[model samples]
Target: MSDDDLAATLATEAGRLLLDVRREFADASVDDRKAAGDQRSHDFLMAALAAERPDDAVLSEEGADDPVRLSSRRVWIVDPLDGTREFSEPGRDDWAVHVALWQDGELVAGAVALPAQGVTLATPTVATPPAAPQHPRIVVSRTRPPDIAM
Candidate 1:
């Protein structure tokens, strides 16, 4: 319904990724063969929808990106698992959970759901708030990529 709602749902879903189960997938590492069909993130978000908004329909990246729901006034766009590659790595920040809502073909709200970081931040409906640069200059992504030290 709202960005806050989506954020809560995504956060809950991503939190489940830290669970222990009989899961093995090939897509993670090059050596493995099969992409494990474990539905950790999928199950969590699906469950969230069931518990939160049972009446609404959903189109998820890791589950089902339904073309039929494109025309709907309010459709939930979810990426249950964004960076399966980085997520598989022992230490990588290339993964993220995305939750967004579209109203009349426009993105009304969005949320970046980070379960590993244990924080859910909502995307502003308008332009993002300007950053208060405490340092001398703005560092581009080309200069910083999380692993490097300042």
Candidate 2:
């Protein structure tokens, strides 16, 4: 599959896996849910990337920061689970899976899978978003906003 397609597919699959994990751990503690989600999703993503792109290096949030990725021409940067807190909380749809491919110092492909929302936004095949409101609102973290947002 093409890099763009691979990214989108992997991200979507990972998101599905996370949803399953969440359901299985619904009655467990918050920490347990978060840990399971992170490890399972990370493992799934790593295995899929290794099988699909054997020669490419991967840098995942849940995996070690391998120095080999720095020298590789193609690297897959992934976040198996982006919002651990929200993911562990029941009924929250803010969590997501992120997959991005960097080639020769440039981003070649990327995808964000929102499993709870049943949305997968991917590059090269993304649709134009609807027009914004007359007064656009800036959304930032409630507890800690970025410097730019400040």
Best by TM-score: 2
Q: Write the residue-wise lDDT of candidate 2 on 1-150 in tens digits.
A: 999999999999999999999989999999999999999999999999999999999999999999999899999999999999999999999999999998999888999999999999999754468998998767568788777677
Q: List the residue pairs that clash in candidate 1.
A: none
lDDT of each candidate versus the true structure: 0.60, 0.94
TM-score of 2: 0.83
- Each prediction's RMSD over C-alphas, in Å, is 7.3, 7.9
- Candidate 1 lDDT (Cα, whole model)? 0.60
Model 2: residues with Cα > 4 Å off, grouped in runs: 125-150
The numbered model that scores best in lDDT is 2
Q: For residues 44-135, what per-residue lDDT tens digits would candidate 1 score against the true structure?
A: 77787657766556788767566667566777777766666556655454556777767677777777765556666776564757888787
